[model samples]
Target chain A: MLTLHNYFRSSTSTRLRAALNLKGLDYDYKAYALLKKETQTPDFLARSPAGLVPVLELDDGTALSQSLAIIEYLEEEYPDPPLLPADARGRARVRALAYMIACEVHPLNNLRVLQYLATQFDQDDQGKAAWFNHWVHQTFRPLEALLADSPETGRYCHGDTPGLADCCLYAQIWNNRRFKVDSSPYPTIERIFAALDELEPFRKAAPPEQPDAT
Target chain B: MLTLHNYFRSSTSTRLRAALNLKGLDYDYKAYALLKKETQTPDFLARSPAGLVPVLELDDGTALSQSLAIIEYLEEEYPDPPLLPADARGRARVRALAYMIACEVHPLNNLRVLQYLATQFDQDDQGKAAWFNHWVHQTFRPLEALLADSPETGRYCHGDTPGLADCCLYAQIWNNRRFKVDSSPYPTIERIFAALDELEPFRKAAPPEQPDAT
Candidate 1:
């Protein structure tokens, strides 16, 4: 059996969980408390060298970190209900949409980056929230524009079927709710999130539905 | 020929340039001066919705954003010198290695993020440099550890052939030089980078070797 080492509230973890659920793959859930520094322990470090969550341990004990990479692995290993598009160009479009949120927004607003801002720059809670919201809006504006403008966009980020970009978008919207970011500005994004929320796979992957949710 | 809208010094652009070089693909280099807010221009934003560097424009006028996604598109379209591994596990390992640098390091230390630190938090050059180095080490230490400890690591990030992870690793080392980061702590990384530097594909794709480099 596989074991998923992650925290419930982590956006990356949420993305991976949705991917796993979408694939109909089951795994043991191992929770790590990020605030308590549980991932920094030697054991967790052995599993994930970066000491970050969403480490997908295979049956052979080969631990794979990086949520996007893990999702790609699952996509490859389990092709049914594919997360990525079949065509290369379509795949590129979906992956590009996914990376826009994964790379541009989430990395800047993740817990560690926020903590670093608070500690290193002495940014207060309001300042941190501002920083988070700033990045969110920065990327979300263009993301919304792209989605709204593109004929390729359907009920989800790509087509009527939910895939990789949907996974990223769904996870990010949940992360935004914690910070109380206004989704009213991105109607396309909001509509997609609502559509995804209606699905069982995405609903089950929500932070509140997780075993370790606070 | 593809049109690559990018900056010479951007780490993501460096990685894509190296990949295109590896694949022996020619592109019309359209330089975006990030510091001058050139990428934020309406013209550039039309090419890339996020206004980010390294947008690969296909001949059909389809613009692909995100360096990794573009590289993957190239890998699928031009599989002569494959950028990823043959097997699922191997591909996962390589992608994980690549994402470690791409998602974790580059996003945090990019030009815009540093400008944000300086403007938003009143961080001086010294503070920005410190912030940059701090992120580099945070990911590099674990990256070095993973590369050093893994038996799968060969001359490059994966096997003897330079691929996706190698492109990311090679570009990041170049980015580090500007920040004057100490590479002594990561001997394996430095050694692999040295090996890669000897290759024309990587050397020609370097920041100093770019047509728009100033």
Candidate 2:
């Protein structure tokens, strides 16, 4: 059996959950409360040395961390309803798009980062909001430019089907809304995100729909 | 012919260069002076919408952005000297290790982020160094634990052979030294890094050896 250790509201967790749903795979959900520091517990740390969420544990107890890595593992092992393109260049483009968000945007503005900003810099709520919005805009502008101009963009970030990039885009858009980031500047992203929201897998895997949602 | 548009000192660029050397592929180097904002030019931006360095341009005019994505593309195109392990679980483990540094550590402490801290938050030199060192340590500790404890770890991060994880780890360690991060705590990382430094591909890819290095 596949079991996932994740938190409902964490963007990384949501990405993994959406991927699982899209792959039609069933997993046991072992949720953590990030706000309560549940991921830092000794047992959780043993399972995930990074003390981050969305770890996938196999039937034999081997665990995988990093949402993108887990999703790629699923792609390699499952190979149906493909999340990546078959062509090499196309696959590169999709992975680049996903990393543009995953590596560039989300890491800088996630919960732990925001907490560090608050504690170390004495950033007030308004300051935190500004920081979040600033990075969202910085990353979104390039993303908008990429999606708006590229012919590869269809109903989703890459094609008509929702894939890895779509999963990341949808999760990021959801997080953007939480911080009240202005989506008016990114019509392409807004459109793709809208399309992703209609998909059953995305809807079912949303943060609010999770069993651990508050 | 392969052409790489990259800045010498950029960690991402160094990672790509090392990967290319590891695969025994030759490329034309189009050096960029990042301090002069060469990456922001219209032509460069046209190729890499993110306006980031280390874009690998193929002979067909296709430009691949994101260092990891480019490396994956190379791995797919050139199977010999495989950067990823053969098994799905092992590949996932390697990718997770790479992402732990790429996504968690490097993103938080890169040039643009440091500039943001300095300008927006009015962080002094000491403050920026503190921020850089803090994140390096924050990431390195768990990494050390994972590498030191994992049975999979050999002479390098995964096996005796250098692969994707080692490329990232070597690049990050080089950057860590720039900020004067104390490496004494991570003997495993230090030992692996020392091993990597002795390899020809890694040595050839060091920042100071590049044409653009100051």
Candidate 3:
């Protein structure tokens, strides 16, 4: 059986869960409390050298980290219900959309980065929240524009199928909403996320659905 | 002809260039001076709302952003000399290694992030350099450990092949060495980088090869 090392409310973990659900794969979850510093333990670091979340321990004993890498591995290992589009360009587009969130937005706002802000710069809650929302706005504006103007955006980010882009965008939107950051600025993002949240895979993969949630 | 929107020293662009070179695909490199705030100009932002470097404009008018996504697209479009390993697990390992550098290391130390540190927090040159090296160490320790212990230590990042991981790792290590960052701590990384630098594709993909370099 596959085992997922995850933390509730981690955008990376949330992304992996969505991919797993979309692929209809079953796995045991080992929840880590990020606030409690469970991820910094030697055992967890051994599983993922980067000490990041969403490590998928395969039955064969290989532990894969990085949400995008894990997602790609799943797509390659299980070709059914394709998460990426068929054509190469389409796949690139899907991956790019995903990266806009994964690489650009979420990296600057993760727990470790935020902790660094508080520890190194003595940023208070207000400072941290502003830092968080600054990135969200820069990213969300483009995302909103893309979703609104591009015909490629269907029920999901690309076509009507729930693909990688939707999975990524949904997770980012969820994080934004959780921080009480206003989403009224991006109606396109809100609309797409609303559609995705209505789906069982996405809704079930949310932070509140996790075993570790309060 | 494929047009690559890039800046000379941007690590992401270097990765794409290496991929292009390794695949033996000829393309036009349209230089964007990132340091001069050229990327934020309206013209570029129209093509890339994120206003980032290493946007690949395909012959069919389709634009691709994100270095990994662009490289993956190239891999799919031109599979002559594969940038990934053959087996699924091997592919996952290559991708994970790539993410180790791309996501964990480069994201924290990139130009914009550094700029934000200075402008937003009044960081001096010393402070900025400290922040840069801090992340390099944070990322390098695990990377060094992975390279030292894993059977994947390889001449490149995986075996003798120069695949996706090698491309990203090589570029980041080059930045490390250029900044006179103490890479002696990561002998495994340094050794692999030395081997990679001897290769023609890597040499050709260096920042000096681009037209924008002073």
For this target, which candidate reaches the highest DockQ against the unseen true structure? 1
List, residue by residue over A1-214, the lDDT tens digit for candidate 3.
9999998899989988999999999999899998888988999888788787889999988899889899999999998999999998788888888988988888888888888888888788888898899888877888788778888888888999998988898788778877788999888778889999999999989989999988
Question: What's the true lDDT of residue B82 in model 1?
Answer: 97
- lDDT per residue as tens, model 2, A143-164: 9999999999998999798899
Per residue, candidate 1 scores C-alpha lDDT tens digits across B1-214 of 7999989999999999999999999999998888899988888888777889899998999898899999999999999999999999999999999999999999999988898998899999899999889999999999999999999999888889999999999999998999999989999999999999999999999999988899
Q: Model 3, stretches more than 4 Å misplaced?
A: none
Could you give candidate 2's per-residue lDDT for residues B101-131 as a string of tens digits?
Answer: 9999999999988998998888998989999
| Model 1 chain A lDDT-worst window of ten | A76-85
Per-residue lDDT of A18 in model 1: 96
Cα error, residue B58 of model 3, in Å, equals 1.6
Off by over 4 Å in 1: none
lDDT of each: 0.93, 0.92, 0.87
Model 2 stretches with alpha carbons more than 4 Å out: none
Worst 10 residues of 3 chain B by lDDT: B171-180
Q: Tens digit of lDDT per residue, candidate 1, span A1-214?
A: 8899999999999999999999999999999999999999999998888999999999999899899999998988899999888899999999999999999999999999999999999999999999999999999999999899999899999989999999999999999999999999899999999999999999999999999898
Best-first order by DockQ = 1, 2, 3
